[model samples]
Target: MTESAFRCLACGDGHSVAVHKAVADYFLPTGIRVDYVRCAACGMVQQYPVPTDVGPFYAAYPVHARKSLLQEVTRRILLSPVYYDVASLRRDQLLLDYGCGDGWFLDRAKRRVSAAYGYEPTAMQASRVAERVGVQVFHDVAALRAPLAGRVDVITMHFVLEHLTDLSGTFALLADLLKPGGTLHAVIPNLDNVEYRGFGSRWHGFDAPRHICFPNADQLKPVLDPLGLRLASDRFVPFPNTLAASLSILFTGRYRLLPFLAFLPLAIVWARLYPRGTRALTFVKHEN
Candidate 1:
């Protein structure tokens, strides 16, 4: 068998070799096989032979659904600090939720800032979100930047960066959009998480095809630090979604809810004991 080769998207390092095999896409169960690679140089994990046509998979994405009251409350408790951090950065400045799927975060942020905007790649969802939120939901960077009229004070890419294909170019665009002294908040899958260790290729974070890159703090910091984006805080966050996805892979080999319910308590305890699977990182753009 010939060993496949890949470069680390986060660090641009060669010598990234396959460490896991035949990982299936947890979301779109197409029976397509892919290898997961870990860069020896920077320790970033990514799927090899990146899926070229992901449009069909995303057309049925479930993020557009409204959250239940309990789910919303739980998110507020666990993630309010993340929003507060954005609000604290500067008052009366625009806040942009990059990859704002359905405008969930932007709807909440509109209350904190004078204006809130969002950028989502899905045109249909972006249009729906713009109508629902009564704020701009742009489908492209140019459309997003034009309305901002100036650099944004804060931007967030919650669980969005991993889905991106171009790490350096994306970060550069983000840096350019940020005002001097502005902040960028991102939450990405932690490759060091217990779930990945326990579940291996089936780990929910893999999300194969869809999640192009997985970078732990060590792997990610070096990529952004040189861009003048200084780390302000780094902390692990608990995501029930990952737990649910893991359980689905374990039992039925698909995303379902019964496993999530059965494993909710264990997931909470796991997060309390080992909160290294997913991380919330805040970075500040250096002032000129």
Candidate 2:
């Protein structure tokens, strides 16, 4: 109804480019209609008119959880480097998982890191995370005071940072939670991927309201660097099932097994063709 406005979450650069105005209903999982835009200055993609109620946006999370064999294999494929990138595996190493929904990754990270904890904004999912993974989940950072302060060795945010409405506050909180050389690991959708170029507004990754910010390598660098964090390494790790799902979405607008007919070769071809474009990334927080 009204023209939306936005200031760049990274550089404070404002924009008014109407790249595409579409509703992402089914895929968002957040169940909120969203308006998408692209920045003219830095080419970053983001959602406009931030949602007022963050509740329904994350309400369907725990209720509609999925951890199939395909998801497990994909996690292994993309998470290997994340483990190797940390390079400090030992017992009693306290780790915090920001926005850990259902604690699937936390379940695995616990095996490597001595101590694992997580915080989930969604109340329903946060409860399940603790019940399922045996880790405590706070409603927000402010809830975590003396106990978690300055004790976490590694802080992780998998597919989490993009949803933040406050980067400065979020990062500052994460920074405070970490020990002196502690690292903050995050994985998010790659805005520079060729799949987005080929699919345009139909790109499956842009799940609208849920994915508020679709940042690329360049967009993320300046944002994190100011927080004493750096992009230690970034790589493309393709998930065959997700790629197949994308192909299904592009063709028929719903996931189907028929397109998975050439699942093997298609996966390899897509991975090779657009390696860096895959929604794969591993970043570490650096200490000054």
Candidate 3:
């Protein structure tokens, strides 16, 4: 509702509007109230005064938690197609799954591709992935670059970009890692979602402190084009859980399923809309 000197993390725009102000009611990692803003120029939504150390917020984060055998099997059957199609993965191509958590996707992807690698933020996760999946996982940028620079054919980010602080720097590193004609595939939550309108700060998409930014697709075009990545395909990815989770926060204080049989149809309708609750975008690196 108000404008200030907030510097947008994605586009460097000065003009912005205060969007939401809320405590971490759902996550409760920190009770401190955080303010969110959307850049008027770029339409990127982000938190103000980005936390100095986000470690505490993720202290109990289930980002890489092991899933049950049934959960793992369900994920393989349902989620693998999204990445494979977006990346156009082939048996001859090498893949690097940036922010690969638990290596579940990479575990299967390695079986299909010529080679597969992973990048995680912690040594514990990197080690778990290496042992469990037998796929090489790296936490050091320098070490990753030494081997992968201009060699990887595809890189994937699954609900990972929003948690990162450095958008520009991350894309630059992606450009360095991918070969010409390579692909950068991602799945991101859409702020344009009708759920955000209905739930406001309580919406799961806001996810407050952990999810730092929600950059519009248009703003990403200029950010990626100069790095030799072109937006090749963009479409909404159905996120049935968004509405249910938001409703849970509205009724219950934490994340748990509530029978909202009435809203199921609305979630289905919103998923098909242009400005959906979630989206998948595929960008192809230009061949020089």
The global C-alpha lDDT for each of the candidates, from Candidate 1 onward, is 0.75, 0.67, 0.77
Per-candidate clashes come to 0, 1, 0
Q: Write the candidate numbers in order of decreasing TM-score.
A: 3, 1, 2
lDDT of 3 at 124: 84
Model 2 error, position 64 (Å): 5.6
**Which stretches in model 1 have alpha-carbon errors above 4 Å?**
1-5, 67-90, 147-150
lDDT of 1 by residue, 147-239 (tens): 564478888898898888778878877887888788888988887766788888777877776788887656777667777788888887666
Q: In angstroms, give how far residue 58 of model 1 lies from its true place.
A: 1.7
Q: Candidate 3 clashing pairs? A: none
Model 2 ranges with Cα > 4 A deviation = 1-4, 26-32, 62-88, 256-265, 272-274, 279-288
lDDT of 1: 0.75
lDDT of 3 by residue, 243-284 (tens): 766777787765553443345456545544534777788899
- Candidate 1, residue 5: the lDDT equals 43
* Error at 153, model 1, angstroms: 1.1
